[model samples]
Target chain A: MSDTTILDQDRDAGFGDYFALLKPRVMSLVVFTAFVGLLVAPGAINPFVGLCAILFIAVGGGASGALNMWWDADIDAKMRRTVKRPIPAGKIEPGEALGLGIALTGFSVIMLFLATNWVAGALLAFTIFFYVVIYTMWLKRWTPQNIVIGGAAGAFPPMIGWAAVTGDIALESILMFALTFAWTPPHFWSLALFVKSDYKDADVPMLTVTHGRRVTRNHILVYTFALAAVAIGLGLTSIGGPAYMAVAVVMNLWFIKGAIDIWRRTDADSEADSHLVERKFFKFSLLYLFVHFGMLLVETSLTPFGLGGWS
Target chain B: MTQIRATHEIHGRRLSRNIGLGIVLVAFVGIVYGLTIAKVGTDPNDDLGAPWAQAQDKAAK
Candidate 1:
């Protein structure tokens, strides 16, 4: 697949493939959490600046995805999960992907600064660099620990949301970062467990590939525990309220229970069975993060009424 | 193969296009500002976060 010559030259760019390169699923979470962070923060930002900040943040998130796809084009072509990606299908060239990613990354960071503050802008810059240079190029092939550490890049949006308001980091913002950072391993490993073939085919090192399914399951359980703790702990903070805490308690339990089911499964159907236990958890994981953050929005909404919050 | 277009060939086209696109972007921003000043100093609503109006009530009061 490194041959690059293998790409289908006849394919034209479709809206969906271009969208796929942006990794809209990941972008949505980034937008949602960043939006919640902006909402919960104690200060005010101009509507124009706030919109630009979110736009740039979304583009930065998308840029990270493009670069990831570019660097992994070789591996991506080999895996069933990504074999149809724009570059692999020759709908977009690897070089095009790289150019788009680098330009957007620079544009996003600069736009973020103009729209918001330097602190948020700087964090956006670091997040893009870390995801591309640090994780994709350096860590992913070499270590199963890649996602665990690289997860920090994904986790920065909420903090960026906070910084955009306060122009600095706050305990509340850090807690949001911590919550997402802690949640990453379990979220990714669950997906890895089901699609172990994707990693194996790509020659990528994932926890399920390196350590085996049971260990992967155990890792998911442990990380899920830590993530749950972080979510609940945020409830005890200035930002959290009865509404947020209630949502956190219910969602975290649902998440942990999902992880537990994955752990207890003795049969993962390694041979094309595509272990549904982890698959189920992976799908739930996306909903888990969105709902948790959405609940924060709910708490903010109900704060005036004084009925649905912690304080 | 009918004709071999090297990677560099496609990339050269993209470079020119992007550069052109970037200049156009700058021009667009300038137009927005120029028109605004010529008319009136109108504030644009570009804020992305939730309005402080809701959170103000929930604030640590």
Candidate 2:
């Protein structure tokens, strides 16, 4: 009886648990960026197929999320931000998640191959492996440079979406990749600023944990500067236009200012939530990427009427 | 002890709940699967041979 209770204490079940494992918030970003990539490509991709590709991309992203939760169940239990995930909450067993993840992985890629070019399908397969193997299992727990390097997995969606339609990669797609890659460190470190103990307790070596808050802040500022350059540079491409450039200019300024503000502040000064400026910046950073990517969709669509590209 | 009965009841409740949760997961996968194949690759074959084949064909005149 004691042993049964012990085993049972290790589990919990709820509908929300599996949903949480999907990392819906992260999947939303993946979908938004992938959709922008699809919309902005320089050809007439079938809208239905484009929509299908986006669906599969979103599912692929969710599969990665599920696999990540399965792998990180140990540390996820310790972090308040991650403690409620399916595996950690005992809603789903790790084996079940792995099985689901693998099955979804196969379905997304194979279905995509049937619907799109093998190029796009191959890219999808690599992305799953990149996030699950390279980032989650290897880089994340092993290195402080995890987000900086592992950031590539999150960045590849736009490229994948572009490949889905074009059956090839392009400069515009790479720029889209660059936008998300450059934005990740600052986005993550800022959250780490507030949840310092979670990473520490979880024994995960987030930038803030290994390098101290000051260093992480400085790194955020640096990445923000690089991100600003990428955004503005993207504004000069064939995919760029007045709408995208306008969004880029405004968002870049705000993002850089936020990073700069964080860079100049100390941990002791930021401890009080009464100000909430850091939290505000972190939240804005989320919207910042979405709006900029969303604007690209607007810009590209507007091209038919002479509102895009150097004009 | 009375605690033993409570623990057993809790475990029973959890197993039932898990099976229920599993059913929903199955349904969700079916939906995503149906949506993926039903919607995506119908004309995606065009994207492969060349970009915008249909549009070009329409304007060939």
Candidate 3:
């Protein structure tokens, strides 16, 4: 069957199928966060250097995605959520994904080192390693806390962006990292709440599958509380201002309320409602991070006019 | 004759993919090589050492 599928795909697959293996959605997040990081840092970057840095970082992120797809193809094929992916759908060979991933990894890292400082280059390399080796290969299969620990891989892009300009990690970049890291748990767990069975089917040991919905709900509420603290704290930093603080306060309040609502519901209640609260919370989580980062970018863009940041 | 045509079609696709991959690989190597030269040549503080070392010496004084 696999051979037959591959033969069919050999005739049908196009460039798009191959590109899908790079996970462009995830790459976009990396690009935006990294760009924000670079722009908000203290020093100025040569526009050319900055563009190259973000491009290479995006490639590194795509490399990480390709490698993840390659490694997770087995379980990915089993899950409804991932069954249509390039490798799982037989649109591309697993070996091709692996090769593309490795080639891009080397190309991105080397080019980034040339384009910017080693600090950013090294961080990009480590992010890929953590995502591919730690999260995808090892943790995704081994522990329920996989997303919790593995979230670091996703959180590194802003720091890499900051390092691209500043050449060092500082309190500001660390805080930026903290914001994303804190936000990841609640964001992912909310999705897990709705799709617990997918994890169960894939045997990926997500928090929901291993701990049950009640514990997962409680975990979501707890992580949301932590995320609020980090988000609110970021507003007090130099990069933040009235604009960011206002958005942060309102969003965090809404986020916390959503978590509490989710926490109070019984699984039966959720099922009766068709997981409405969970679905809404999951969708809102996307905006939660986006607005927070968008507010930061807004504030930074206003800085040249002397109207941004705390006085 | 039909079986032979199908096999030929499969082989043609495979060959096309290989050629595409080869071109991409070559382009990637060229980009890296060009960027390395540009970066090293332009930045006195780059890893190639001599130019950057002289710049650092000038800065120290």
Against the true structure, what is each candidate's TM-score? Answer: 0.79, 0.81, 0.85
- Write down the C-alpha DockQ for each prediction: 0.08, 0.18, 0.16
Task: Give the per-residue lDDT digits (tens) of candidate 3, residues A185-226.
Answer: 899989988864666777888777678889999999999999
Docking class of 2: incorrect
- lDDT for each candidate structure: 0.80, 0.82, 0.87
Ranking by TM-score: 3, 2, 1
For model 3, the stretches where C-alpha displacement exceeds 4 angstroms are A1-13, B1-61
Candidate 1: residue A218 Cα off by (Å): 1.1
Which 10 consecutive positions of candidate 2 chain A have the poorest summed lDDT? A9-18
Which run of 10 residues does model 3 chain A get worst, by summed lDDT?
Answer: A7-16
The full ranking of all candidates by lDDT, starting with the best, is 3, 2, 1
Question: In model 3, what are the clashing residue pairs, if there are any?
Answer: none
lDDT of 1 by residue, A1-311 (tens): 45454344234454455557889988988998898898888877756567667777898999999999999999989988788888987778888888889888988888777667799999999988988899999998999888887888889999998888889998889999988899899988887766536677777888777887788888989999999989998888878888788778888998999888887777535434557667778998888887888888888888778865666
In terms of lDDT, the best-performing candidate is: 3
In model 2, the runs with Cα more than 4 Å from the true position are A1-16, A272-275, B1-61
TM-score of chain B of each: 0.53, 0.49, 0.60
> lDDT of model 3 at residue A37?
94
Residue pairs in clash, model 2: A12-A90, A115-B41
DockQ score, prediction 3: 0.16
